[model samples]
Target chain A: MYRISDQQVDFILADIKKHGIRIESLQQNLLDHICIIIEQNLEQHDDFEKFYREIIKTFYKEELKEIEEEAIFLVKSKGPFLLLSRLQFFLLLFITFIGPYITYDLVWFFNEGHGSVLPVEVWSGTMVFATFPLLVLLVLYFTPEKLDPLIPRKSKILLGIRPFIKIIPPTEKYASYQQ
Target chain B: MIYSSELIKGTLKTIVLKLLTDNKKMYGYEITQKVKELTLDRIQITEGALYPTLHALEAEGLVTIKTEFIGKRVRKYYSLSRAGKTKAKEKLNELSNFMETMISLLDIKPKTI
Candidate 1:
């Protein structure tokens, strides 16, 4: 049987969480995985550090980032409807794109006999009306509206850019000291 | 040493899955050490390499983890799932065939250069 230090356990948990894996039950599961690895290595008389490094090297390969990104994409694709924020984005886009067209049609109907409104004039006016609301909606969307204290600031920025960058902040330091 | 790395790389997953199949449960370090001892240090797997594979296997649902407490520390143990066992058997069979082919090819001697 191999014994894992609480510190190491905390580190692994933090690393897993950092990658956006949310499984409360898996905490102990991960610990068990590490302990078994360590114990088996010790049985063979390998030094602790060498054994530890080998395990880490295999798991944290450069391709892991790509694999994670693909996983996230798979999840997002499978449950497209669950992404309310993305739905909101499309809603906003629809309103921005078609809102002015409707307004222009209404204006044309009301002012039909006064004079012909040139296509260029209608387009210019529609663009002017659409730009401001679109900008406002975009600003609102991009703003850090929600504050999650558990997330690190750097990680938050990275996450905001793309789901591909699943950087999880190290929370073990705090968790270990607390325990 | 000549063909050891290639052999290890080709058979790594089968070796790991087979060990898990037989041992019932293991942890990261234990797997590496077991491989080293079993091969007499001829095929050493670094922790950096092993942990990632373990994690990947867990991700793939091939293994499940169980935790135990030992004096204020927690040790993680991994065991193969049912699916993992099936996978192990298939992979081992494939590896066996590949190895046989390679051995036969290597045994062949060119006539008169």
Candidate 2:
């Protein structure tokens, strides 16, 4: 229920900035929170500067720095993964739909005069290649290289079968075997 | 009378979600103070720790934040999104069940089953 003038707010902002809160949203939240804490203190204490100093003293400055660093990190690191996932999603979606039909036609074109049952090599190759995109997607989804974009960045744990998570798809290796 | 830091760490998310479930909306500082008051200062959620949780919750689509301008500063008030509301209930129920199980284990009565 207490209020301060613009000048006092500026001083509070300066103090927060000086302490190294760089994220814009965090700075804003901290500004409001600090002011409210100050107002609460003002009801009991007379001096703004002294009360403000004392309240911040209760906080771990390292923790404050951690908050800022965490926010920035969550944004910078996760932003790319989220984008990459979306791109991967769309790319895979496109291939899943279109790839099989193309593979079937290509297999048929080379072996048009063959009987109803296709050759084992053609059938097997088509099966592997057709399911390639989906297999990659399942691997990516389950063995998440990063945390869900929604989870806090600091909570990044290499979840789910960590040893097998870093699978390099057998596309190139399989191609070598084909030769 | 503060609780161990480790104990508080695991439960913080559920605590935040549960608090939001009970209240219409709460700001960062308000959430901290409420937790302190409710627990009689035994559980103090520091500003440093609380903000990350809130941000993470926001990212998870569990909570939606509304920013209001009061004079020169911005006040961010967080409320549960629809999914958040459901998640809050589930998390609290899970925690309640876990607590009951822990209590039963400590009591150590041999089961007839």
Candidate 3:
């Protein structure tokens, strides 16, 4: 079994930080994980740097920074989040912008003077407020993947506390990694 | 046969939580190894997914961390917090229901081991 030296441990820790892990706790988590893999797999004389490069590459598709980003994302999104389909996201938007006016119109129509006829502003408000979301929905729904990369095809929108909104790919995307 | 990662993704949290319940405490790497061993190498939890989820669990107070210094590094051992114990049961029950629903919905027959 290979033993990791203090110098090598320091080197790995620094490298983890350099690669974009800013959170001290996360850095330590990754540091211990990397060291264990190295000591368990490598022979005493194996090139540590070369082996590290290969091992680290397996952790992410693009950049190592992604781990830190993902950690922050998960923590921030933990409180309250709604994962909605595209159609549902649009519906939520529609309700947020237009639901108030319809409620007001219904309340006014039932009160006394208005009778069954809805207020003129209700129709106007609906049209004015609805157009933007409608156009947004159309653009988001009709555009190609590249054009609407923020909300890709078959993706869900995560309405969360911190990032506010994020596009989540299908569950298959999360499960794509296997060792 | 190795199950697909997609099949594992939805249940990863539950699996991790369940493992914690079964064991007194565990670290990140030990959890991965235990999962592989218990599943007979059918399921592999990637570090990329595991660390973030662990951090989130810690942040949510679902897991309590105990750190120890070994050689030149800090190793954090995670055990279920009070909330985590409750959450583990809740998650397990939820996953059990989901699995049953899928079994019925897809008309999948369970293979006898």
Clashing pairs in 2: none
Off by over 4 Å in 3: A79-157, A166-179
- Candidate DockQ values, in order, are 0.15, 0.23, 0.56
What's the lDDT for all of these models? Answer: 0.58, 0.69, 0.82
Residue B88, candidate 1: Cα error in Å is: 0.7
iRMSD in angstroms, per model: 8.0, 6.7, 2.0
Off by over 4 Å in 2: A43-45, A61-63, A70-179, B108-113
Q: Which of 2 and 3 is ahead in DockQ?
A: 3
Ranking by DockQ: 3, 2, 1
What tens-digit string does per-residue lDDT give for candidate 3 at A1-179? 98888998999889889988899988888889988999899998899989988998988777787887777766766556677788798778768766786777667767846446665777788678777777776776678475656677787777767658877655323222221
> Every prediction's TM-score for the first chain?
0.41, 0.40, 0.61
| TM-score sort, best first | 3, 2, 1
Worst 10 residues of 3 chain B by lDDT: B4-13
Runs in model 1 with CA error above 4 Å?
A1-179, B1-6, B108-113
In the range A1-179, model 1's lDDT, one tens digit per residue, is 55656675676667656654454433344445555667655654456666765664565435223334423333333211222233354464567675767677677857775565647777677677777777755554455345333333333112222342333433211111111
CAPRI grade of model 1? incorrect
Residues B1-113, model 2: lDDT tens digits = 79976677668889999999999999988899899999999999977667767776787789998989888888999999999999998999998998889779899666683
